[model samples]
Target: MSIERIISRQYEIANGISNDIGLPKFKKYAMCNLRGGIGKTTLAFNLSYLTNDLLAVDTCPQGNLSYFFDNQYYSSQAPTVRDLILPYLVPGLGKATRVASYVGATNEYFADKNVYYIPSTEELYLLPSQLITAINQALGLQGAQKEQSLKSILYSLKEEIDREMEQNQLERCLIDTSPFFAGATQLAWYAADALVIPVRTDQQSVKSLELLINTLTSPQSEFRKYLPTNDLKVPQIQMVVLTHCGWSTVSGARNEPNQQTKVYLKKVFDILSRHRTLLSTGDPSNHLFMLDDFLGSGRISSVESKPLSLLHSGETKVIDRVRVSVNKSVDKCKHQLQYINQQLWG
Candidate 1:
């Protein structure tokens, strides 16, 4: 399809949206790892906000990704991912508009970028029992039914957005999950088309990556063992992102990663190479994407200035300087975003 046609289709969905049909199934990817503090949420925020035609779902109780795009959602009583899946759990309770209803628009930096996000809140932590019940109810005698439950709920959420919105414009779904694999995160995995794991260049992160690979690929891994039947499958990992590489100094000198980080990166590279046939990115080098600390610095998003903006309001020179700095940082992330796009659609 031509870009114009694709945009027109997305615009049509956005314009006629009211509770409706699932047009095209958006490519769904779960951004996760078994460990936290690996910049998963931050990466999610950047990818969702910077990229067009993407929907971000925050399943972590932390709600960091929600707050990243707009701090207002932190305390807002808006419905959340937990709310969206609530009805499915309690069979008799009609599915409420919890998740879809709470979807919010991005602010100025990403203004009207054709992006929508389902925020999260601490309240999600208390809903494990409800999720388990819903899972059990959704799962019939077959393991495939278990997986179907995940897809059905998410698809319903997507279709609901299609019906209620100005346009059901979501083309790609980026899900940010908690470290655990049992509850909401597990459901996110089942509903997704692929996985994007963000791992720091550290030994612990490397170990976590190894464990995640096993869980997704090994037949006897915990994920498969717990799925009730042998037929239930997990999404293939799209790629592993390496974040927090050595920071680039103000003087424009880039620091070197520590020896340990180099060792771990090599180890991860080797592991991905060994599993090339199973990975979306066949080459180890292609699968391991790197992001430097400079790109993640807060200079671009500092809140010391106006509340609704990312730019400074000082003199024109100051504003020009800020713009240059921000654009540079954005440019630095282009490769990362491009790689993510390829993994999602390629």
Candidate 2:
């Protein structure tokens, strides 16, 4: 398909993902930047879990949504998001589930559902290499086509989501993506109709935001051709730049935050607005715009939980997610969704 086709197709996919699948009416895009430690995984996990538990009532025997919390989420035979989901994308018995949710207890097909997880594992750390190899294979002299290989992955996700809604009552599919750019980031952006970018009000995140804009707008960037979707409506890009604001510095703090952090934060918001405007195709008044999710102002925070790796606590304490001085981060995430609806559909 042409780049325009790919980009426009995302809107159709969004319609399928939302109303067809029974998800929140407004949500269609996703956030899966390659930046690390920006809580991408956390956001994915939390979103999927919440959507499954809250949005849709009917589930499979294995609970396609529930498996994300478990350690043995994917089978060894089919690793990575593409591996587990690709097989079931086309017409098949369990293709209804769309993504591979879980193997039956006997390692057979699902009892009766079509939802699969893009598994996360230590071995999956090899996904980047696997993706590179696949890309190479795609463009060979007698090539299968690199674009199709990537497009297939997106189809796998959308198809499973659509299928599951057919059989069971599957509303939303929250895909947790690997951190950092590689093939995975491309897949997520291509699949997503919109994107939610959560940024901490720190220097590192601010710098990363500028870099992301360059990547998105670059001529060589793969996402450009697909923008503006089919009718040139929906713009095919939704961004939510959240301030990971909280307070809880440390035991002892010598000084307040530096001026550099503030400058960088403003720059991020400015660029974010401009990016939203571009994404909206300079409509002066278009719904495809960026919003801020600020639970509270900035503050240092503590992290008392273990690493998501679930590494055992040793002599020193491990941090699962950072503890924010603000008690409303969770609420903030929720509130932004409402804003998303207002902006996208209202």
Candidate 3:
């Protein structure tokens, strides 16, 4: 079947589901994909503008998202996500700290917006091994019980974040997950109400999507296998963003995705069709959004730690000793983000 036809059919299915059962309102969104360099962090940072009172969580050990929000976090002795999860890892330590105590406001760029973030630390790299050791040493818990205990430890952060949100009146929580589905990323899945997966226009990303879906749905997969025995729930796939899509010029005007992009998009749509139950039901238009490859604009925004909405066209910045100019791309990028935000929360 043609890609367009498949998308139409999927849309019909989604619309029917929406009409029958109603859509879920998601307050916590996890930006995730099994592949890296697909603009997951960028989407998380930009989407913070979706709400005025926002709490962004950096679950990646690399701390890229944390740095973007506040570079000083790396140099200073600030509390991080590591601090929040440390108590659970060490038995002698006191209970987990309040999430609000660890959260810090964003830098000057986001000063106008009430944005707070749980910074990341390089020490999070050691979490997986430490978590496993902690889980195995728990007394009287075996097999599924042990797994449930591990899940509870990982999920504790989410519970605290929920309380923090209630106490502080935060409107939304956005979790920036690591590419690997281990440690903190697992915690992100447990915490999120929904997921926004960003896929690059490439074969590797397609395979990564398949792997991610398997981890979420396949009966024999690591995470899914535990679901039947435990009360664990995986977040639904709320949106699949096709990032870095290329546009070709036709008769001196650029419109629609390029041929290569279309081909991969078909592959993606095909994968999603087989797992319709995993998708969130709502307006079909909200299920997918194509984002252009605004390479220069993206670099500038990341380097400056600003959202596309705050960036202007025709701006030039020196990146790596090269003067890169931002053309009209920023406008389109900003518009796409706004549309996505509206679909998600408007």
Candidate 4:
């Protein structure tokens, strides 16, 4: 008969009606901060791995997150983020039959969970130009239609996700984007139901937080101007996470954060605390939280190199001392990540 009838028939065969198929609460989060060196990739990597049934989308041109999971797997002619996203801009590239085709599962990083990630490549750098044109064209559209352009393009994929979630396929979508708040970053923000901004305890981070807060609060900001009005509320569903707080002490005792870090931390806490209040009272959108995850100088996971989280030493020479240092550093980093998550969704 009709398409609607076909869908109804399929639902009947599945032993359930549309009403019985209660989809899980899907959460799309974008982890971003304008400042570089803030361990955004590292936080993204660990969080993605730790989260259950997650689809991690990497929008960074650096491809650091892709590298973490054996870049070869993601880079082996598989559909990259650019391939999937640009189709929306160009049109007529043939619909993505299986959206999961663009994703790659973790080889063996986590024993219990299989985290799928949308890989990025160096060629994604060319996206800025195409993205600008698409955004401009979207802006040119009239009335509410223009506002929905961004979100509408991703609607099919989101529907597929909802269907999968209804079938217990995946539970979450985590978006990891580049440092700049433009192009792909804007798309991630538009798609996210919530945001997790990872910040470092540094002067630049303080400034970045200020800028982020001001931009999201002000309707006149350029970032705010381009956001799809359909399902976008930047400030209400956002959380701030502090990373890389220095705790090193030469006296063989754990030390507090440096004075500069402490000062900036206080400033950030004050800013986010106010936003948290606004999000609670005015918006009442999900939950807003601030977390502290201390990461020292441990080597972060990358395609070319692995994490030092499992460092060992067979030699009895200086390697023994090196192992101790690496082990201690990794422990602190892992603890920080766990603490951040505990505060974020707990």
Candidate 5:
């Protein structure tokens, strides 16, 4: 009866991750999207290092994660852990992608770290052409199928990663994606275990998230048709991290808005809630929470930063004569993640 109902749609996603679980569930990627300086890199880098308990791949053109991992800030001045990623990096590639040079990292054992990091280099700027040459060199396979060539290249990379993981029986993967959503972003999403977006609650940034969801859901998108079904579901977006935010006159600004800024941001976040739910992702109750006032809370390490790290949750303390709510929001995130992981594992 409506124009929306006039079209047909279908998606045939593969099942079965190569795990001992014996079912089709394997989490291979953890990609994120948000602009530069939105703490996207921080969330990705720290979470990867923490969760995987090993090296993390920083796959971006700017090489943020990659550089951080290699620099003295992270460890001794060793040949970057990225060297381990060399085997994964291609040789004399097709389509000429500006792939990260595995040039320095020639160690076989270093790549053996539970986590294998693939840093984004300026070479990524030339990746499109590199891919083609890779295939051509493999056996001189080329033709009009050229358009669909990327799919094969991507699948090959995934296979290699999976092979390495299976051979080593590693824990999981943590992949940091590029800033934008197409090109490299597409590759990372297809390989992701889960996604976590860092949301900065300025009016403009909020608008971008709105636009992203709308664009992804729009009819023109390849994934759009599957929106109403489970097939088009986005990989698990574990949580939305809101940063660079300050309380905007909770009591003085027009009746304090009757709702907290964190709460309103939650509504904006829901634009992708369905995708998270479909993938059986999210901790629901606490998955929707706010970062404590950074200034009010004073500098402290994330409790999750260390296993068994404990802190008082839901405590109300007075700061600078202002009875600001601290620890409550953060506690909510911890609790939410705890419950969600339990449910998922069970």
Candidate 6:
């Protein structure tokens, strides 16, 4: 499909979804992509601001999403996502824990908007082995029993978060994951109702999409191999957002994805076409969206822990003792994000 047609279909779907007065179909979404540098963290941070009652969860040990909400937060901080998992690591220590105990309020910028998040710590890097040891020692059993036990521990966190959302009256939850498909990333997938996978306009990013599909859908793949039954449901692909797309002016007035972007986009569509069963819509165009490259504005937003919607053109800020201007690109980025939010939950 052409980029213009895809945008039109997305807008049409967004309008229909936004007009509905009922609740959204999916309350939990995971921002997932096996490849890094595709703007997953940035999108998750910005989408959290689309509504006041949304909760953002940082499941990656790298903690980039947590840093975007609170730059001052350190790896040493208490009550991180690690705290939520520690209790379940030991068999007897497991108990009904409140998700609110680990959640922290966002920085001042997001605080007034009533946004909250569960932070992550680097210590989470040690969890996979620790979890494996705990599971092995608990029972001398091997194979499927071990896999089910591990998933039970990981999934308990999601159950607690659901209860917290209900008690606090939150509207939705967005989870940011690590690029690797193991550990916390697995937890995010097991917890999500749907997934928003971001792909950059590159051959490697396109390949990552196929890898993700295989891992989730192929019975021989690691994740699906253990859980062969539909009892542990795999999240459906809600959308595949093309990030950092190159754009060029067309007809002297409108801008559209440049030729290079179109080439890769065709490849993406070809791949998605073969896996229609994994998608939320039969028409791939309805599930595709693009965000033009806005590196200058994105850098400032990341450093300042602010969303593009709050940024303005002609704004200036000092970075490393040098003054930098926030140009009109900020507005373009904000418009793209707003449209995406409408398609997602409006």
Candidate 6 backbone collisions, by pair:
18-346
> Which scores better on lDDT, 1 or 2?
1
- lDDT tens readout by residue for model 3, 1-346: 3455423333333222222223456889889998899999989888885466888899898888888877676896777777777787786776544444222354676766777777788898988887667656653478777776666676766876786677777888888989998778877888888899999999999999999999987788655554444577778988888888876667653346678888877778778777777888733334666777878888888888877778788899999999987768676677677656655555
**Per-prediction CA RMSD (Å):** 10.0, 11.8, 4.7, 12.6, 11.4, 3.5
* Local error of candidate 5 at residue 145 (angstroms): 5.7
Which candidate model has the greater lDDT, 2 or 3?
3
211 Cα displacement, candidate 6 (Å):
0.9
Q: How accurate is candidate 2 locally (lDDT)?
A: 0.40
In model 6, where do residues sit more than 4 Å from their true spots?
1-4, 7-24, 94-106, 134-151, 250-253
| After superposition, candidate 3 runs with Cα above 4 Å error | 1-23, 96-106, 138-148, 227-230, 252-254, 282-286
Q: Model 4, range 1-346, lDDT digits (tens) per residue?
A: 1122322322222222212222123377778888788878877777765567777777898887777765564446766666667777776776443334222344455445656666777776777677778778887888878877855553433443444444446767777888887667766765666667777777788788777777666777755666546465553444566565553354643334545555655666666556664342332122222223422223424422344333332211233244212334444455445544543443
lDDT of each structure? 0.60, 0.40, 0.74, 0.57, 0.43, 0.74
Task: Give model 6's clash tally.
Answer: 1
Looking at model 4, residue 261 earns an lDDT score of 52
Q: What is the lDDT of residue 105 in candidate 2?
A: 35
* Per-residue C-alpha lDDT of model 2 across residues 1-346, encoded as one tens digit per residue: 1122322322333233312212223334455454566655444433432233112111112223234343344454433344444343233524323333332332222223333343434443454565556545544524334455544543444444445444445444444444455544555555445555666666677667667666667656544442323412222444434344332255553212234433544455456556654453332123222222322211211132111212221223223465444333333334434443434333
What is candidate 1's lDDT per residue for 108-208, written digit by digit as tens?
55665777777777877776666656545666546666676655553443444343333455567788999876667767776676788888878888888
